[model samples]
Target: MKKVLLYLKSYWKFALLAALLMGVEVTMDLLQPKLMEKIIDIGIAGMNLDFVLKTCLLMIGITIIGLFGGVGCSIFSTIAAQNIGADLRNDLFAKIQSFSFKNLDELNTGNLITVLTNDINTIQRIIMMGLAMMVRSPLLVIGSFIMAIITIPKLSWIIVLITPIIVAVLLTVNKRVYPLFYKVQQKLDQINTVIQENLAGIRVVKAFVRSNHEKERFRQSNEDYMLANITANQTMAVVMPLMILILNLAIVAVVWFGGIEINQGNLQAGSVIAFINYLMRLLQSLTMLGMVLIDISRATVSANRVENILKIEPTIKADHKQDDTFEIKGQIIFEDVSFSYDEDGEPTLSNLNFTIEAGETVGILGETGSGKSTLIQLIPRLYDVSSGRILIDGRDITEISPKTLRKQIGLVLQEAILFSGTIKENIGFGTGQISDQEMVEAAQIAQAEEFISSFKDSYDSPLSQRGVNLSGGQKQRLSIARTLALKTPILIFDDSTSAVDTKTESLILEALQQKRKDTTNIIIAQRISSIIEADKILVLEDGQITAIGTHQELLTTSKIYQDIYNSQFAKEEKNYA
Candidate 1:
């Protein structure tokens, strides 16, 4: 709640003005009934035409003024609510952007999307109503009550008796529905997660012929969300009927007693009419007020969810004082670094120590789960070392902020992710000021130029979400091109070229050798042919570096390396026969 309210401070002035205008509107609404009393009891009773016309003109003037006040209230409330929403949305997205990979693991992508879009929109609706209807409803209720008491004291007891029952009803409904609303939101997250997975893996689902299975899966999630929503609505659905019953009963009591008052000369006919008018207005306000409270109940749940995002401190804190202008020459050192996803679980990489000189090409080869990806990720502080330290250019990487360090290192992970954009735009994503020539050069190096030019639009060809229009190998090559365009001193390919064939992979490696030979390159590959020419090859088995030497030296000394070589090239050599 504290964090969520911080956004309101920026628009408090507009909100205050909206509240003031709403007050004026409600005040004018209250005044009209009193003016009706005077026009009926005095002007019409005495048949004073001038007095009636004067009151009529005055009422028209007040109505027009109230209309302007209502319009102004609406305008200011809209501006304030929209600006606050925009700020909240932007701030939330930026916060998510700074979250560590570990943080993302806790908050799934679907839940984060729901909070950013749907939850924030809920807060906006509540804010807009809070500034507009929230102010008007309470004012009208209180003003009507006070005016009814002053106008006809004899009939005001009914209002006093009825108000408490309505308040109790609202409070009861709020309590019963708040927890149910939270469940509804979680159900919504589940529905969104199911949809996201289906769409992202639509091809896999189709190839496996699981459309009917997927439909049933989605149907179950949807039914759960529907059930949760209906349960919450069922609890809250009683509020209006109870309020109306109480309000109508109060009106009945007013009419019953006021008739006797008028018959006994204790109340004027006009006074009874005016009191009834105030009662109806109070009824309308209370009805709206009930809905406002229900919405407020729901909004509070969303507010807490959004606030959790704002309140959670990122696991990774960047060093603000680090010099952004400082350069990295790509000299890397890892001394006894150990890491595990779960702190209590077995280490992914344990007590590993290695050094790569500047402008060196080091190869990392291991079986699955040997932590090849984890090893390269530590250099950029994607995940900090669990035990020891990593150094770049003789400075501790942890001492250097992630932003400053990552800018000099380019990483292409095993997964190929591309946004919906032009081929040139995707390649030039991070490399600012990339001309057509640079785009072409980067594509050539990644060996993606031929297929890109085959399309009629060439670099301008549009891409769909995740570049689904491209084949797996094309996506990987495009990802590589994006990294190469940055021209960073250090590049880590975490099996990024696995989808590309050996011929294209050979061409890409050859291009990298000619174009960026001085760049410190780290290659994580399964095939032995890919890393045979590396200056130093580290053979990893079960998170331990068993051999650190040239490929030739590993073949002679490390049985694991020899076995891998035999499984790959030795079989290939025999197949050629």
Candidate 2:
């Protein structure tokens, strides 16, 4: 909570101004009860019409001054709170962008979204409320209490007796509701997770006829979220009535005792009336403060959540001390590299020792879960090796800046992700600037230009979110085109062409060989034909390299490669027959 409050440092002036204005409003409010006492005891009792009228005018003028203070406070508080929210949100997003793949994996997308949007909004509102009421309530309470004591010191014991009970109630409610609000935020995360999953995979749900199942899943999550909210609100709702009951009882005690004092010679009617007014102001301010404290409790929970994100240092940070001015030649060496998603778990790629020379085309063949994707991911430093080192050129990859290193390597993940935009924008998403000729050339190389040109708008055609309007093959082609546009010295395709036809895949591979011959290429593919002509192929089984040779050499040298080639070849022959 304290860490998150630093966001207000830049806007503290506005917050302080708001608080000062609120104090003006509270001062006016406190003075009004005392003026009423003057009107009753001095002006009315003495039968002086001029004094009564003059005091009434003064009260009206004070009310007008207070109105300006209240309005100014609102404007400044909004400025302070809104700016703080925006700055905090922007910083949080920037921090998330700096996170490594492992960090992202550790933080759930749903939870991150909830914290960035809902939790931040909660803190923003509390800041606004606090800036206004935080000053007003305490000043009003203290001023009113002092005036009440000065008015009738004997009657002040009623307030002294009631204050402890209100404080006790407030403390109890605060303890009970903090955990509930925390649960509410967690439930909201679950709701968001369910919604995000359903939307992202809606096509799969429809294809599998699992819409009903998804609906049930969403229904259950929503209900849980709703129940959590209701439980928290119900706890707060109970506190409100209990507080009002205590307040009303205190007021009744004041009225009862004040009547007795008035009947005696100790208190006048005007004094009794003023004392009741002061008592109401003081107690009501305490109640309002109680409500603000409850809100502060919720905001504290949200602050901690936001603070947790801000406190996280990205697992991978670029070393600025290393000289990164040297040009990359695309020679990648993995020396005794090993990695695991979990520290205690088995290594996903154990003792990976390989060297791909500059401008060489290397194909990686592995069974499912052989860590093919993981291996490619390591090349881009998406996830660093748990043990050992990767060398680019001759320097350890850790010595190079990640941004500079990634710029020289073009990676196409197994899943092709496209943002909502025109085809041209999608192609230029990474490089930022591409001439029409360059864009067309990349699309052609990926075997995507033919289908793309068929559209009325061609490259200008708009794409739905994640390119849902395009086929799997088209999206994969676009993904390849996007990466190919970079024209990096090192290219990695992690099953990027699997969805395209064999002929299209062949064409793309031929294009890559012709156009990027001077660039190193690493391809991970399931099909033997896709990698048959490669200069070298790696056969992997259970995260270990079983074979490394040309296709014909592998057929004779490696049992795993032979088995894969024979099974695939036999299936093709049987289909043709």
Candidate 3:
């Protein structure tokens, strides 16, 4: 709550101004009822035209002031709400971007989306209403009650007795509705998760012929969301009718008691009428107060959800301060490194140690879950090691700022992710300017030049989200081109060439040899031929290094390497005929 409140501190002055205008509006409303009593008893009944005219003109002027006050209050409230909302949305997105892979694993994407959009909008609406009616409604309720008591003192006890009963009923109804709203938010998160999963993997879903199953899944989530909302609405629906019923009983008491006083010559007709008007205002404000409390109840749940995200301290922050001017030459060393996704679970990569001198190409071969991807991810500090240390140029990676560290390293994951933009823009995304010559060189190395040039727009052709318009091999090459364009000292490819043919893969490797021979490279591949010619290869089994040698050295000494070599090459030799 405190973290969420800090976002509103900058807009406090505007919020206050809007609340003050709302107070003025409420004050104008209260004064008119009192003036009506005078117009009825003193002007109309007394046969005085001059006094009636003056009072009517005064009422008209006050009404205009009230109208202007309401309009000004709404304008100010909107400004304050929008400013807070923009700041909050930007802050939430920035915080999410700051999260490490581990942090993301703890918080799912669908929940984050729900909080950023729906929950933040909920808080914004509350701010607008809090600035406008939240202040005025309570004031009007209190002022109306006091004026009613003054107008008919003998019947004032009727209001005093009934106010507590109305309040109790409101509290009873609101308590049940308040807790149900949390379930509504949770259900919304589930629905968003299903929708995001379906859209993101639509190809896999349809290819597997699971469309009916997916539809059922979505139907279940949608039905749950609707039911949760229906329950909340049904619970809140009791407050208004319950409030009006209690109010009518109070009104009946006031009218009956006041009639006796009027018959006894203790109260004037004007006083009875004024008291009834004040009672109406009192009931109306009380009704609005009930509705606002319900709004606050729901908004409170959303605020807490939003506040949870704001309060998360990234576990993988760069806590080790170091001199910013130090240069790194990309000499990577892993000493007794171990890592686990769960703190208490078994390590994914355990007690592994290796070194790579600058400009050396190292290949990693391992089966799935053998920690091939996890090994390279540690060098960039995407997830910190559970134990031991990694040093770049003899400096512990903890000491290097993530921005500076990642600036010097380029990574291409197994799944390529491309934004919706021109091919030139994607390759030049982080490298600043890319002359036609630089782009062509990078594309040639990635083996993407032939296909990209085939398009009418060439380098200017636009891509869809995640490069969906491109084929699997084309997407991988474009992804490779993007990384190659960075011109970083250290580049890591984690099974990034699985989709390309052997011939294209060989051509891409040949192009890289000619264009970027000096760049330190680490290639992780499932196929033996992909990494057989590396300067050194590390064979992994169950997170342990079983063998580390050149292809020729491992072909004689390591049985696993021999099996992999034979399995991939024997088939190719047979197909050559």
TM-scores of the models, in the order given:
0.96, 0.97, 0.97
The Cα error of candidate 3 at residue 511, in Å, is: 1.8
The lDDT, on a scale of 0 to 1, for candidate 3 is: 0.87
Best-fitting candidate, measured by lDDT?
A: 2
Which portions of model 3 miss their true places by more than 4 Å? none
RMSD of each: 1.8, 1.6, 1.4
On the 0 to 100 scale, the lDDT of residue 433 in model 2 is: 98
Whole-model lDDT values for every prediction: 0.89, 0.90, 0.87
Per-residue lDDT tens digits for candidate 1, residues 1-577, read 5677678899999999999999989999999999999999999988998999999999999999999889999999988889988999998999998988777778877888889989999998889888999999999999999999999987777888877777777777777887898899999999999998898899899999999999999999999999999999998788777777777787778888998988888877788888888988887798788778878878888898898998878887786776677699989999998999878999999999999998898999999889999899889888878999998998988888788888899999889999999999999998766999899999999999999999999999999989999999999999999999999999999998899998899899989999998899999998878888899999888898989999889989999888898889778889887
Candidate 2 per-residue C-alpha lDDT over 446-483 given as tens digits, one digit per residue, 9 for 90 to 100? 99999999999999999999998999999999999999
Candidate 2 clash figure, as a count: 0
Query: Which candidate, 2 or 3, would have the higher lDDT against the true structure?
Result: 2
Clashing pairs in 2: none
